[model samples]
Target: MPRRIVIVGHGMVGARFVEEVRRHDPAGERASLTVFGAESHPAYNRVLLSTVVAGGLTAASIGLHDPDWATRRRVTLRTGVAVTAIDRPARRVLLADGTSEPYDELVLATGSRAWVPPTDGLLAEDGALADGVATFRDLDDCARILELGRPGGRVAVLGGGLLGLEAARGLVGRGVRVTVLHPHPHLMERQLDPGASGVLAAALGKLGVDVRLNVMAKRWTPELGLECDDGTTLSVDAVVVSAGVRPETDLADDAGIAVDRGILVDDRMGTSDDRVHAIGDCARHPGTVSGLVQPGFEQAEVLAGLLTGADPAARYLGTPLVTRLKARDIDLAAVGDPLVEPGAEWADASVEVLRFEDPFRGRYAKIVLRHDRLVGAIMLGVPDAAASVIQLFDSGAPVPSDRLALLLGRALPGEATSAGGPVGSPALLPSGALICRCNTVSKGALLTAWRAGATDVAALSKVTRAGTGCGSCQSAVSGICDWLAAAEPAELGEGAA
Candidate 1:
């Protein structure tokens, strides 16, 4: 008999676990899976919610599964069902509907929730969102913000992190005047240096966003807008909070599971109870920065292999930090340890740092190297440089001895870059070179999937998930598809150049 597996939470990581399980146990000979979701709708891509707010995509367009997906895969999927408690002794989960489901193995994927700052009037007396206030977390929040945002109205975005910045950009794109409130010296302090942050703020300012740094919201007045700690009040139509998120771990703690910051898991994603496993934002693996989808997706794959007995040796160590701000007219990617102190910030003479800042043109490029290998980078408004730098970073290949050439998206003599890339042509990249940092998709994977009938960008994304994560690699994936089509014009059955 197949091992019975019950999964809680139907967010991105949870849905991915289901797919990974089916991939390993294709014939269902290893595991019988049942998934429960608190939300009424099926899984959708939450990363693209900002795009939806910008009118670039409809809310209906980001569905991860079709209506018959669960039925076709022979998996029991219960939506709009909340698991209120985990009955560990009985090895069953109690549902809010007063029902219970026994499980031989349990997986928790309850992702994080949007954190609303404790500003006055942001929350109602009952602790729900107050009127004229919204959050940028889920689909419902997206709709609420859209309703409150008018073409000429003003909106205040709290926080200046990736999601917060994305929300500000989206709202501005909708013709709403937007102000970004960040309680830090610079934006994206985790991923960018002060210089890069200044350049980014300038770029956003040019795009009509008003950015205020080191500012805190004192309160939100529904009738008068937001009051800041600076003793100034801005009249806005709505306040969208993207302060941050806390992992959803109430159920795990209630069930006597070990949790610190999140449900604690080992390298194998097993919690204190060997029968219970955890992944996604709700679970904390040692040395991983949570609240990102990439880590969770990788964890799901690793856990799936172990549970399905497909790859018994699979273990998730950690995901290298990669941050991308997906906003209009903004192209930025911070990879690896970009937080490493720059010139004066550190006394390490062994580190080699290179920087090029063109604030006028809204471009900044910084590369950190040690032992002749690329370690980290910050690239904004330089897509070409980003592609080359990321490839070198992922492959641990030594960068060009001429740091100037590498920073400007140029190659040394006798390079393939004449075809318009620092690394020459996309075809010349090492097969192991990573193309999509968010999805961890490699060039070789794209080639294989393309040969298997995924000829265009959309098809390749569907087959290999190249352009789905942060969407920063969409252009790169499209370029690879074009190159493949041009390289083998006859082999592409359809959608060929």
Candidate 2:
């Protein structure tokens, strides 16, 4: 008999694992699988939950279409079933319901939870785990914040990271007075530089968000509001903590899995115990636990190979370059180290520095380059340039003599060398061209599945395993389904949506 697999979490990483496992054994001949999710609702896009409150999507619309995906894959999905403990010695999982399930091979995809700092008086009259003070990490958290929607309401968002800013933006759009407090001076410190962060700070200020920098939240006063270390207090209601995430390795720790910051694993995503594996934000392979979606998907791919009895030799190097998808503005991106070299001297014009700052128009574009290498770039009103920049960085192609021309379609004299491409050809598509990056499914694969009679996005997901991770790619995948249905001359149903 095939080995029984029990996956702990049904979030993005776990969901991708299910997709990969099923895709590897579509005929359900290789393995028996089960997924236990802590959340009652089916998996939705956690990344875009802020967008849901910002009027970008609805509650039902945010959820994944494959509610019975596990069932279809012959993998049992137990939503709201919390796994309290794992008995690795016996290869069994202890559930909160006092039921224990045995597995020959176990995968702990238990994703991370939001790190909530200890605060003062912010909690309800009840205690620390109060109803009022919350963290926006899941759909239920989004719902709670949405429930607190009142015009001109004072709301405080702690952390000032991407999630915090997104949450503040959503709250502000809803007429809530939003203030973002961060201990650090810059936002998205990990992804952006000081100069870019300065630009972002100014942009956020224009949005009526009071951006507090270099001031840590000392404590919380239930009545007066947040107490800052700088001896100042902001009178606000409700504090949403977005202060990063710690890996969910408690289960792994209890199960005697080697862990350092996160559950330790190899390139194959296998734990020290060969029969066990881990993925997503939970697993720290080679001193890294990638919290980003791309790395997590890559990890899923690695784990998928291992479970299917493949060579599993494909090593997962860390994601060196990545694109940032801003919610409502310019594409502020970083590929490799964009920081300036110490004591390096050069004329400003010699190195291309395109600066388009129109404060009145709320637009800013500054691209820093040293000898046409595409070192660093920042844009306030240019998202189209983002794709090109990412492509240039990804391919490491030598920049055309006139770098600005590539950005703005202006042909400097003698700078028209190999620009543009075959409009209708597949060569234009990135080898890693994602039909849905959220689920790590490729366009070519999705198209092949579509031609194979997987007509709708929902059916396409059940077949091709797309749009199952983050629902951000759902819009793109849905568009593809529409194209296939229209181009194929088929009578499509509501599933096309």
Over 1-497, each residue of candidate 2 has an lDDT whose tens digit, in order, gives 77688888888778777777777888667778888998998777676787886777787886664566666778778899999888877889999999999998888888888887766655565555454466878898888788765568888888888788888888888888988888887887876666667777787788878899988888876677788889988888777888888889999888787888888887778887887788888988763436667678778777777777653576676654454543554345454545444444643554655555555554545555666766665544444454355445545666677666656523222211110111122223443454454445765676678768887877898786575554434555675566556553332222221
Model 2: pairs clashing at backbone N, Cα or C within 3 Å: none
lDDT of each: 0.86, 0.69
Number of residue pairs clashing in candidate 1, backbone atoms closer than 3 angstroms, sequence gap of 3 or more or interchain? 2
Poorest 10 consecutive residues of model 2 by lDDT? 414-423
Over 4 Å off in model 1, which ranges?
342-347, 412-424, 488-497
TM-score (C-alpha) between model 1 and the true structure: 0.94
Best by lDDT: 1
Write down the RMSD of candidate 2 (Cα, Å).
5.9
Best TM-score among the predictions, by candidate number: 1
Backbone atom clashes (below 3 Å) for every candidate: 2, 0
